[model samples]
Target: MSDLPPLDPPEGDGPDEAPDMAAAELALGLLDGDERAVAIRRVLAEPGFARSVDRWRTHLAQLFDLWPAVEAPDLFARIERSLDRPVEAPVATLALAPPTKSRLWPALAGLSSIAAAGLLVVLVARPVPVPPAPSARPTAPVVATRAPTLVAAIDPETAGVATVTAVYDAQAGAIRLTEAKLVGDDHSAELWVIPADGTPHSLGLLRARGGTALTLSRDNRARIAAGAVLAVTVEPIKGSPTGLPTGPVVAKGTLSPV
Candidate 1:
């Protein structure tokens, strides 16, 4: 058997056709943290993926068995009986095996032109478990920033748009929404926060069209952080009926250092 799999796949084994790359990575212990976490969840939740992981493990074991056996080096001191001369001794020195070309990298490289294609391929191959179905309730988007303060741009006017901005004082637990375009007589602009976990939390309705300030609950305030997604949705005069967004996400932005 070959010591390693082919660096390139045969025709038809393109990205669209390959689903075992992730399984190979997982079995090789290449994935880390959330990436690994997601893969593990899929391994348990997806029977097909689990089977792929098993197959990769078997193949890896075969590869190891094919590796050329290396003998350990040793050193010793010896004396000649006639001259009583000390001879060079064989000393065993610890050594590490040279890094071999990984099959994962070749597979990922052949599949994608992207730099760091392994990570991109893993991500592009499968979604990170957000964007639930329409029938399901939406959760907050992942909060990726650690900024003490955050600001966002909100412009949802389809006819005549105006500059709108929002600032969240995470420490003070206060959020201020300033709009150049006021909500119409019956329409209200609702505020929503999408957390790192990718769940949506409605902050509340914007009471003033020009500007409004409100404090978030203890639980909701904790969701304010860098890389968090802030969104504004236009709901009825009273806001969304289902608590989840019922209207389009007209405006959105990421959290940044204040």
Candidate 2:
């Protein structure tokens, strides 16, 4: 057997076919048991056969586990059949052994090219989303309009003080007091709006100087239109004892439409 010719694979096989022949030889070597470990390792290094390498490893591991109990007939028959088949050559076959030092750079460059192409594909396919503008939505203005009736000032007096000037704008339905002054020390001032005919409604406390203005509610519009009396009293800080004026009259005004 040693002197016999190296088994020449069937006709049409040439040195160009050496790689496929080598792979088959490696596969058969895996079943032989002696060099099976080395051959299996070599098959794992071939990219084209890498997936099969895992299957081969699992099969071999099972064979090793059953080695003592029974022979792996199925595994041996499969390898034999595979070796008998004509080698359909791989378009590119990697060396089963490690590459020469000189080829390392070329292999690295090829892998980098593949990675760069993958990154470029990802960047081109995915786009970043832009946020919408805030001002695109509408917003209302603050301080919508002037209060219909604004009381501008108040006057305080000890007794029998009169004259509260009402600045009325008929179209806007508003009235404002332009002047209110306290005449004496004994009396406190209060503000009221008299409608066209109804009783005086208390707006709020009145200050002697730099007096404040008060806005009336919408419900008072009709009564104000009917001529309700706007009057002021020199009420105690707790307010007029009787719901009506107990203190001296201080100032009075009416709301005109605006």
Candidate 3:
């Protein structure tokens, strides 16, 4: 925490009190660069600040959702108007004359209406993407994070010479399956998710060799809460026909907290 960048100074007159205006400005994209970075940090770290930001976002979204659709002014026409201004031209050459002014962006400053038009287009049905959301950022590899995850070992001795491993990613709601010992191609390795109630649920099948990722449904994810068991069984191609296990359990282990 000490190594992280210092947060931007709060905007209120008092040191402890930050005005809701700060959150509104952040949500409205009034802050740029380091100020925006500080706001993003607050959104993730402080629940109160996050709620303020969400409230401002919802308020603004509702206000604009009912706003009348406005057509965009012709951009090319505005550019033409900007170019139509009288200016001295080089008469020495028969070739095309170069532009007299260097500040073209400043000249087209009137295009704010065009920006509003783009907003209208987005408001019709689609959304204009907002940045700095959690999903908008690149994810760090699971191995690189400091947070503990869950890993369970599949039954190693029963199936083959190779050992099998299962690592669960709670954020992604998926389990990664790694097989060090390859099973024969003729059979299938089906994964069973054993809940605390001693009931077994099928999580799907695994590959005969290498690694595979198995995703769990919302209800199934609840069953995987700590103290659950994960195991692999040798079954017929595709998986078990009956809901219950038909083949012998090859590998089984209780889920462990990292």
Please name the candidate that would achieve the greatest lDDT relative to the true structure. 3
lDDT of 3 by residue, 1-258 (tens): 279787876667474575457789898999999989999999999999999999999988867756665554446544444434434123223333333222322232223222232223222322222211224444333333433457665545543243445677787789876543434677787888998899889998887655688888888787886678887777788988997788887777667765
Q: Ten-residue segment with the worst summed lDDT in candidate 3?
A: 125-134
Top TM-score prediction, candidate number: 3
Tens digits of per-residue lDDT, candidate 1, 21-128, equal: 788899999999998999899999999999999999998897775676454332111111212222322121222222232323233322211222323333343332
Give the runs in model 2 whose Cα sits over 4 Å from its true position.
Answer: 1-163, 167-175, 183-186, 196-198, 218-222, 253-258
Candidate 1 TM-score, C-alpha based = 0.40
Ranking by lDDT: 3, 1, 2
Which tens-of-lDDT digit does each residue in 178-235 have in candidate 2? 3356434445666666654556666555566543445555654444542345677778
- Give the poorly placed runs of model 3, Cα more than 4 Å off: 1-148, 180-182
Give candidate 3's total backbone clashes.
Answer: 3
Quantify all predictions' global Cα lDDT against the true fold: 0.63, 0.46, 0.63
